[model samples]
Target chain A: MRRFFAAGLTLLLVCAATALAVHAADGTVYGKGVTLTESVPIADLMADPEAWVGKRVRVEGLVVDVCKKRGCWMELAGGENQPAVRIKVEDGVIVFPLEARGHEAVAEGVFTRIVLDDGLGEAHSHEGHDAESCRKETRPGVIYLIRGTGAIIR
Target chain B: MAGSAPRANHRVRRWLRVIHRDAGYLAVGLTLVYAVSGVAVNHVADWNPSRVIERVERPLDLGDVRTDDALVDAVGAALGIDTPPARTFRATADRLLLFWDGMTVEADLARGMATIETVRDRPVLRQVNLLHLNEPKGWWTLVADLYAVVLAFLALSGMFLLRGRQGLAGRGKWLVGAGLALPLIALLLLRGGP
Candidate 1:
């Protein structure tokens, strides 16, 4: 009975610690050069992507997804079920936190639109996918982008 | 026949013991690594067991060279990335994908904002889980299979380590029986009734 009780206690403690660790890992702050300031709603900017293209803009939205390969880009959740806007940053310069998923972020960058071509070997590397899957999914499409220079993962 | 050699059975048993002991010694380090990572990975719902990725915010000023090659060159120069990307994919009109050996970059053409996210290993845990996950495929798979065979040998030889009171014929019988039965009991209790 004593051994059984001890085992039960150990199990309970382990379960609690696991939960605590996960909570602790949940919070990610990508604070460096990116600072949140005077951003418009993502929906508003995306509405006139052509007008915003080649123009610097700031937008705020909840992050629905992030590139798992590199924190190079993130998709901001759209308002009213609109498609999320993809914000791209130069790899290694301004990396968004992968853990920043489900958090809100304010991004300052150029709002631009591009017609992607299949000349690319692989598809857009989005949310944790292997290269094969990405290659398969790689197809020509139009995308709205924020050339994000600074971003704050709130 | 070779199989009919006088003490062939005894010789074979001796060889098995030698092989088991040496293989067990060699596998001890890997076993410990996987054992620790296994516990951590089993509760993946509670946490991420592999891949420690980090991101940071930084600024860039692009001087209008603006051509695709020049952009890649300029960004590579800015980041001080010694090697050029293996492939660069234009994902969208403004977004560029730069693929490196193990690193990647997403660049936006409209604005010169660059976000660099990199994969970092979590000290020993990353390597541990790599082995546990059998990540290094090809030759490593064969090696892992050999290790599995060795472990089976260890368990089997362990039962015969002693004789009479401690050997498989005696107390070892009960211990081994329980060891094997425990898993079945767990499976039935956890999966059968439901």
Candidate 2:
């Protein structure tokens, strides 16, 4: 009976630790929490997003915008004239607070470029926003974003 | 021998009833949270379940605020907001955005308009929705999984709680079949099910 009590106590403590780890430090960790150490400048990534496609990279920048509907994505500010790079996560997997805009964030994810066909003639919807509202499209058709795995917003 | 078999069956049914009742009691709180949040989330396409957002537009005349610092100070003064914004971004030469906790300002430098949007958590609903959505993962995941198991057990045990015409072998079976068929029918109608 004493051994069983001890084991139960240990399991509870482990669970407590896991819960604390999700919101551990000064910053709130979302999803699995950013793991990559090296940083890639948002400017550089936006300038040549295609080269980084399919590769996991970490980016640090000011959170300029977030998905208001679902908290599924955030736009990180790039350089002076460069458009912000979007870090898109699967909805509900990670919820970026609408208030996270303006805070500094570090996110790790695989860079991706989604090519839209002209034949479809439909402007893609980025979760809630219609094509007219989606500002991240590379040109008239392609969308460039990071398929985010985790992030830390300070 | 027939009496013994019925007696044993009655004893098992009694035990099942006790278990089902206790489990139902145990599940009340979490069940309420999940049920309410589930309905709110299902209609997420129509509204935000966790936060309430309000937007207001105010006119402000900041005579030619050129630099970033000047713009922040001017906007702060006009809005009577003493606290500095967390960050500011220049979306365009004519547009500047200032952000604070639960609040955002979109300033039209060309037109002297400030659109202030404030977001607030929806009281008890927000807290329950967080648990329902599994936002506080880790330990909560285990809690949710355990709740799911408890719910399954309660459902199965409930079928055996009644006997005769009201039991699984009678009208209860038809009710259960209808309950199961609804989802399958929905799948066929909506997703062209396998």
Candidate 3:
């Protein structure tokens, strides 16, 4: 009886330690030292037309929304046209603050490029469809898309 | 029957130990993969740690929207496609749209400018991310669900694998407590305000 208890206890500790190690490593690699360029204070990256266009700079803000599926994209607090950088979270990296939309966050990635259709520029154009579908057909060099690895949300 | 019982009990215990240990080892790597991917994906608004950079350039003229058909033909020619364009439209007088490869292309019809953008799917990470998200689908979802249950089992069984002062009752318990507390504290801080 005592031996069984001991074995169980050992297994538990190992598992816990493994979990901690996994979390620690992920946090260090993905959340420690990332920066972005853009000082806009809105939630939608498309809202701010000038601040984000044709520029590469780092900005700090909050995460306003996240995708439930494969975490394809996230929204920030910059506004409609000149919002904070909309992050395309890498497929396998795990981020913190899973559920809170209004949480303060700091992201570091390139302000590359994005191009939206002129017709869908109006706010009400995408009423029933998902937001991803509303994005204008993505063009190559016409828009800036940020790509980064590290983020911290307080 | 009584004489055979001890041997059967011994055999069962041995098999249990073997299954438990081997399963634990097999699960360790996958656990890390899922756990890391899960946390990163949860906070999608935060940032992407593993992003690949890509660049594309196409030479074309954007001065005339009426010549857009020629532009598409040129693109199709460049891509070595002989089939008629599945569909074509103008995103703008300056921008021409082309559809291919389950993706869309937008180009400047007048300026000879073309931009190609596609979501970069990280190699192993993409599949791991799918598993972590638990998308309700075919066998993958079922496997993920099973992995979740196994993780719970591993966590519970792990507590017993150690012994004495370093075991669950001592240092083990402390470590577990700390692990649980860290997330809880973060949650509390995030909630803020009464």
Candidate 4:
């Protein structure tokens, strides 16, 4: 009887420990879809992003930020003077990890510039929760995006 | 009249029993799947419910590893795997990362240490958990809706299964009421909090 109780206690402890690990996002993500054939440095692409617009090209760079809510997109740093580009994946398809910041990543996608309106621009911000805040108006500057089909992060 | 009423009651009870039992039987497989995965997922901290992460460590003889290719080759040779990485990058002077589908290798150039980490789907758990997770879209969602209908049918059929002293009018009502109250009480307690 004592042995059975001890075994049960051990099993409970093991299960409890396992539960805790599932809560946090593990800093790991699998590569999605095709391994893109060619990659360009983020610095070079930022210089002539328009040239690569609508073209599928891979880019490797240091990841600066990731969406805290859903891992649907990330921002990768470019050259010192260049604006970091956002890499957006289709929702429920390929999810980027929230813990991918500071890691080097290679993404392959179409590079395009989007003109932001109050509705669309605020949809991409972190604090744009409510309908009012999500509709926060901003000047229509170019929002460079590398809408990625596949990615590898480390 | 008395005999006819008893016969009608008996017939209704028989049909209800058949429906409840059959529905319960059909739901057994899904119930077990949901229950097992549910328990595993609830803890969220102790283990990875979706994938089992397999880790292997090795020491690389980084003799002349200067370029990214050389570093990948060294790690690959250490692990004795032939496939080239999907992507490789040097994050810092001391660190290099090689990525493949479901796998990652980190090389510490300064320490000559290398580690390969891979994730594997956890057998039955992964498949069942997919339904539990609602990550699988499209037709599977429709199947889940069907399952919900079965559940509602079972719950309603069950309430009508018993009669007399052992029925909903007696001890059974108290049990069912407690079952309903528990979740409501928990919700109330949690409403003002996190």
List the RMSD of every prediction in angstroms: 19.3, 4.1, 17.3, 12.6
Question: Cα RMSD for candidate 4?
Answer: 12.6
Off by over 4 Å in 1: A1-154, B1-20, B26-51, B59-65, B73-87, B100-102, B109-112, B121-139, B169-174, B189-194
Per-candidate local distance difference test: 0.64, 0.82, 0.54, 0.68
Give the best candidate by lDDT: 2
Task: Kindly give the stretch of ten consecutive residues in candidate 4 chain B with the minimal lDDT sum.
Answer: B133-142
DockQ of 2: 0.43
lDDT of 3 by residue, A1-154 (tens): 7998899779767865775575466342343345444454433345564566555444555454444333445555542223344565554454432232444556666565434444444422222123333232433224445555556554
Local lDDT at A49 for model 4: 76
Better of 2 and 3 by TM-score: 2
Ranking by DockQ: 2, 4, 3, 1
Q: What is the DockQ of each candidate?
A: 0.02, 0.43, 0.03, 0.05
**Model 4 TM-score (B-chain only):** 0.81
> How much does candidate 2 score in TM-score?
0.86
Which candidate's TM-score is highest? 2
Docking class of 1: incorrect
Candidate 4 local Cα displacement, residue A143, angstroms: 16
Model 3 lDDT, residue B158, Cα: 74
Kindly state the fnat score of candidate 4.
Answer: 0.00
